[model samples]
Target chain A: AQSVTQPDIHITVSEGASLELRCNYSYGATPYLFWYVQSPGQGLQLLLKYFSGDTLVQGIKGFEAEFKRSQSSFNLRKPSVHWSDAAEYFCAVGAGPTGKLIFGQGTTLQVKP
Target chain B: IAGITQAPTSQILAAGRRMTLRCTQDMRHNAMYWYRQDLGLGLRLIHYSNTAGTTGKGEVPDGYSVSRANTDDFPLTLASAVPSQTSVYFCASSVGSSGANVLTFGAGSRLTVL
Candidate 1:
């Protein structure tokens, strides 16, 4: 079965520091990977997606993700973390032809002043 | 706005009661879905509709049901609410049922069954 795994449940980073959130997926074929962010009391927003071509995909709010086919991972990275970047991040893999997504347990990022 | 809208931002219900979570999308997307979010469980798909008049069961669909009478509406119904059904329900839609389509999510409805 197709599935996604986000290793870190919670992560804290100092403002302006570099950040990386790890994600790994298990799928039978070429995977469609995505990263989504959810603010408190709000719906999820798409950050980035990797369907094909270009391993490094950039997204909104200065977020980027690299899809490593060999490792079956698509980890999100940010060069400088901001206070507003504190939110729950989810890694998901698009499954089948229905566009259904299999999401991993989210990683909560907390920015420290 | 041209996005998904979910009704009953939050609701408290007693076990054995019936409840419906309404979802409407003005985007006129071809695919709509319902998912339940829980701590440590991520989000599990409850049900999905590929198009009008067709529905499919998802990862978790034992106690829940759905009907898609039209392209814009997909309401999830709980035949008999249970304590385990307490969750934050999210309704999402995509332009199509292809892997390349990105899903747009609603603000979500927090449901509590006591």
Candidate 2:
């Protein structure tokens, strides 16, 4: 079965610091990867996705993710984290032709002042 | 706006009661999906529809039912609500059934079965 794993459950970083959220996925063929962010009491928003192009993909709100096929990893990165960047992050892999997504357990980000 | 809209942002219901969470999209997406979000579980897909008249089961389809009668509407129905069904349900739609397409999600409906 295809699955996504986010090792870090929670992370705290000072405002303006760099951030990296780890993600790993297991699938049979070349996988379609994605990163999503959910603000408090709001719907999830797509951050970035890796389908077939460049390994490093840019997304909304200055977010970027690098998809590494060797390690089955798609890690999200931000150069400088803002206070407003505190939210839950999820990594998902599109499974098969039906467009079903297998999501990882979310990582809660806490931005400290 | 061209986005997904879900009705009854939040609802509380007694166990064994019938409930329906409504979802509609103006994007004219060809694919619609229902997923339940829980703490520590991220989001688990309950059902999906590839087009107007087709539906399919997903990872966690039990205890939930759905119908896609038209292009815009995909309502999820719980025949008999149970306490375990309390969750934040999200409705999402994509341009097509291809895995490469991005999914646009609604604000989600918080359901509480007491």
Candidate 3:
């Protein structure tokens, strides 16, 4: 079974500071990676996804993630996070055509002014 | 565009009562899925339907039942609701089986079993 791990439970950062949310996965074969963001009382929105090709992938809202096969990591990063960017972030890995996605515990991002 | 619509955005059901969470998608996607989200745990798949007629069990399917009569609808039901079933449920859909099958999610249906 494929699984995702998000080490950080909560993250607090200043309004203009750079941010990174760590994610690790355990899969036997090439994994399909993705990052999603959810605001309070809302469904998740896809931030980005990595299928193949380049290791680094850019997504909406100035977010990016890099897939490292060697370390089995796909970490989400932002150059400067805004107050509006504060939300819960999730890392997920897809499993074939079943359309099943294994997600991480999630990280609550707090943007401080 | 109404990507996905889930009825009774929020609900409160008594224990042992029957409840059905409705999910409808306008995308006419080939695959639809149901997932429950808890406080500590990420979204866990409850059930999934590859197309209109084929349904499959997900990670947590013991307490839930689903039916896919057509392409647009995938309803999840609980014959006897329990306290442990209280959680926010989300409905998602995708085009088909692929490497980068991105899923579009519904607003979510929050159910509380009292």
Candidate 4:
């Protein structure tokens, strides 16, 4: 079974500072990877997804992730983060063409002023 | 129009009681999914339907049942609610079975089993 791992339990970054959230996955074949964000009491919103193509995938809210096959990692990055970007972020893994996603525990982001 | 609406946005039920969490989508999507979110555990799929009348078990299907009578509705039911079942439930839908299928999620249904 495919699984995702998010090493960070919590992250705190100052406003306008660059940020990176780490994610790793275990899959045999080409895996479908995704990043989702959830606000308090709300469902998850997709940040981005990577299937099979360019290693780097861009997403909304100025977020992006790069898929590294060698390291089995798909780390999310942003040049600058705003206070509004503070939320619980999750990394998901799915089998190719199945449309089924399995998510990691999650990493909560805190924006410091 | 409500993109996806879940009935009884929040519910508090006693242990051993039976409850159903309703989900409906108006986008005419071909696939619908049910997932539960718990603190420290991101999101786990409870059930999924490829289309109307076809349902599949996800990672955690214990104590949960689902039915898909039409293209728009995929409701999840629990025969006996337990404290372990207390969590926020989310309903999502996607277009096809492609690798890049992006899911559109509902606001969520919060359930607290006392």
For model 1, residues A1-113, the per-residue Cα lDDT tens digits are 89899999999999999999999999999999999999999889999999989999999999999999889999999999999999999999999899899999999999999
Span of ten consecutive residues with least summed lDDT in model 3 chain A? A94-103
For model 1, the stretches where C-alpha displacement exceeds 4 angstroms are none
What is the docking quality class of candidate 1?
A: high
Expressed as tens digits, the lDDT of each residue in A1-110 for candidate 3 is 78999999999999999999999999988999999999998899999999899999999999999999999999999999999999999999998768779999999999
Cα lDDT for residue A89, model 4? 97
Residues A1-113, candidate 4: write the lDDT tens digits.
68889999999999999999999999998888999999987888999999889999999999999999999999999999999999999998875665778899999999999
**lDDT at A61 for candidate 3?**
94
lDDT tens digits by residue: candidate 1, B1-114: 699999999999999999999999999899999999999999999999989999999999999999999999999999999999999999999999977789999999999999
Clashing pairs in 3: none
Per-residue lDDT for A73 in model 4? 99
TM-score of chain A of 4: 0.95
DockQ score for candidate 1:
0.88
Worst 10 residues of 2 chain B by lDDT: B94-103
Task: Order the candidates by DockQ, highest first.
Answer: 1, 2, 3, 4
lDDT, model 3: 0.93
Q: Tens digit of lDDT per residue, candidate 4, span B36-64?
A: 99888888989999888999998899999
How is the predicted docking of candidate 2 categorized under the CAPRI scheme?
high
In candidate 1 chain B, where is summed lDDT lowest over 10 consecutive residues?
B94-103
DockQ for each model: 0.88, 0.84, 0.71, 0.70
TM-scores, in order shown?
Answer: 0.99, 0.99, 0.98, 0.96
